[model samples]
Target: MKGNRRSEMSVTEMFSYIQGFLSADQDVREDIRKVVQNLEQTAREILTLLQSVHQPSGFKEIPSKCAKARELFSTVRTQMAELKTKFPVEQYYRFHEHWRFVLQRLAFLAAFVVYLENETLVTREEVAQILGIEVVREKGFHLDVEDFLAGVLIMASELSRLAVNSVTAGDYSRPLRISNFINELDSGFRLLNLKNDPLRKRYDGLKYDVKKIEEVVYDVSIRGLAKEPESGGDK
Candidate 1:
């Protein structure tokens, strides 16, 4: 009889513990959702600002747009820091799905700003720094490599569209530069042994971006719209 009583007590205690755990999980998820919503809002604002690059006169204002976007990242940094504290570091992956999409968007925004400023791919370290997160997982919340690559793929697509718009904007030289950038980016992506399905799918879309940019460049070159490479150098 005592053994059965003990068994009943153990079962009750186990369920009590599970109930508490589930409650805490729900609370944490709710908090994370609120924070992610804020992050998404910031991302939309930055995306809107950057979309101006598609306009005929937008190319000339890129520096200003990038500067404005840089300031907004400070807000993102604060929100991310708050988000990091909502759950234990060990539970990162447990709740990662809640914020993964927002983080990817933030990564893309940072990459877009860097590309506009220097026409170079933003490093993982740079993206993490811009987002005010860690590069190493042990240090706490960090940017996943897959997220960074996804962002780069997104940037490649955006650049391909820019190649088309640059022509309409009377900037023929920009399409050639974008073509070279996307071609090299495609080559780099080919070397990664990707396993993540979403990332792999994104990488697959890169070829279409490459094709579009190439078409823009070809149209420019065949029509004598491209600038001639300088003596002793082909760009």
Candidate 2:
């Protein structure tokens, strides 16, 4: 009877432990929250830009990609400015600092790597979308952003595995997954620069959503990578 009671308590304790760990997955929550916030900013800035371009804003249900892009550009510039001002995180394990960054970059990479390694060809529309590519129109297909996210999510898993190590290395306010994404993102931005187009110079001036995201990504990464503040200097 005593053994049975002890076993029951052990089971209960195990359940509690599992729940506690799951609930306290701070990195998971933080990464997700950051993603959500960035998406929010994207939507807002995109809206403002689109409105400016469209005049009526919602005259048509499906707007042109150019209009959408213009909208995307408008708010991203301003939002990024605000993000740069709010230096929330101290360490930049994920960046020079923390901000609205990808929780999905590493994961996206991981999933893509696996699909390639396994010779698994993606057939779904959603899978291709998250990869930031065009997809085929299939019969009876409800293709949408969800499909892309699904594909990207597969990569995100691998990213999480590689990135978690960095977080373990650093204390709170440092996440390596975020750092890796930012680093890659920073490289991507510089690589995409065009110098010859009519709007090349203007593009440089107009804030890309990429740059806004960078601010947050760099912010987090900076906090993680920054040298700890010197102690006993003047205070």
Candidate 3:
């Protein structure tokens, strides 16, 4: 009888432990959701601001837009910093899913700002710096490589659309520059041994972006809107 009583006590204790664990998990997730919501809001603002690049006179406003986006990223960093504190450092992966999508959006926004300001691809390290996260996984709450690549792919697509708008805005030279940039970016992507399905899918979409920009460049070149490349080879 005593043995059966002990067994019942053990079973009850196990369930009690599990219930407590589940409760704690729920609380942490709720906190994380709140932080992630803030991050998403800031990301949306940045995206909206950057979308002006496709406007008729958007090129003229890039500098100001980039500056505003930078200010929004500062808010993202603060929210990310708060997110990092919601869960234990060692459990980064455990809670990362809650913020993964937002992180990718933030990465894309940072990349977009960098490109608008400097016409250069923002490095993964630079994205992390902009989002105020660590570059090293061991340091906790770091940006994942896949997320960065996804952002770059998204930026490439945006650039493709920008190439079309640049022509409408009477900036034929910009398409040629965009074509070269996308080509180089495509080549760099081909060199990676990507195993992530989502990232690989994004990489595949890059070819379409490449083709679209190429068509823009071709149309611009054939119409004599842009200077022709030298006869020998690409300059």
Which residue runs of candidate 3 sit more than 4 Å off their true CA positions?
228-235
- Residues 1-235, candidate 2: write the lDDT tens digits: 9999999999999999999877665554566456447746565443343333222222222235334553444444454444433433332233322331232332233234333223233344433333232234342112233333433433333333323432333322223323445345335335654657433443343234334434544554666543454221111
Give the winner by TM-score: 1
Task: Quote each prediction's TM-score.
Answer: 0.95, 0.28, 0.94
Candidate 1 lDDT (Cα, 0 to 1): 0.89
* Each model's lDDT: 0.89, 0.39, 0.88
Summing lDDT over every window of 10 consecutive residues in candidate 1, give the lowest-scoring window: 226-235
Which of 1 and 2 is the better model by TM-score? 1
Q: Is candidate 1 or candidate 2 better by lDDT?
A: 1
Identify the leading candidate in terms of lDDT: 1
Model 3: lDDT equals: 0.88
**Selected candidate, larger TM-score, 1 vs 3:** 1
Candidate 2 local lDDT, residue 3: 98
Task: List clash counts for every candidate, in order.
Answer: 0, 40, 0
Which segments of model 2 are wrong by more than 4 Å? 24-27, 56-235
lDDT of 3 by residue, 1-235 (tens): 9999999999999999999999999999999999999889989999999998788867788889999999988998899889988998888888878988888888888998998888889998999999999889997789988888899999999999988988887778888888989999999999999876888988999999999999999998889978744321111
